[model samples]
Target: MTEKKLKVDLSVPFPTEREAQIACGTLSVDSEPKRGGVKKELVVKGNVLNIHFEALEARMMRVGMNSFFDHLNLVIETMEKFGPPEK
Candidate 1:
């Protein structure tokens, strides 16, 4: 029998391309290699950040997504607080 897998795709937009790149690079650095069933990808395209996630089980996928969003919120907050003055 074959195992089932799941994926989640997300895109986040920032006010500037530099901000998007910063977030992409920072988050990418924080990511750890998976030894089991989860994978993540992040890319920056102009002022947008694209995220992809893959997991082996529904529960794992859900947990991964939730954790990602939580970390994302922190990243956004940090950018807002420490990023260059917004225009």
Candidate 2:
């Protein structure tokens, strides 16, 4: 039997395009691990960062999303603490 594909979409808005770009760059560096059965994609448009996730199972999707949120929180915190990088 063919496995079903589950998906999730997330959008995060930053204060500026630069900040959004920075977050996308930082977060995109770590692709989802192969064993997790999840795939992730990141993109930045204007001041918004978009994330797309696909997984074979709901559990896998939940785990992947939790991990992503952890990293995203760090990125936002870092931006809030230190601001965006220099142009």
TM-scores of the models, in the given order? 0.84, 0.93
**Model 1, 1-87: lDDT tens per residue?**
987679888999999988888788778876644754678899898999999999988877777778778888888899888966455
Sequence-dependent TM-score of model 2: 0.93
Model 1 whole-model lDDT (C-alpha atoms): 0.82
Question: What local distance difference test score does each model get?
Answer: 0.82, 0.92
Task: State the lDDT of candidate 2 residue by residue for 1-87, as single tens digits.
Answer: 998899899899988999999999999998888999999999898999999999999999999999999999999998889966788
Where does candidate 1 have its weakest 10-residue lDDT segment?
A: 29-38
* Clashes in predicted model 1: 0
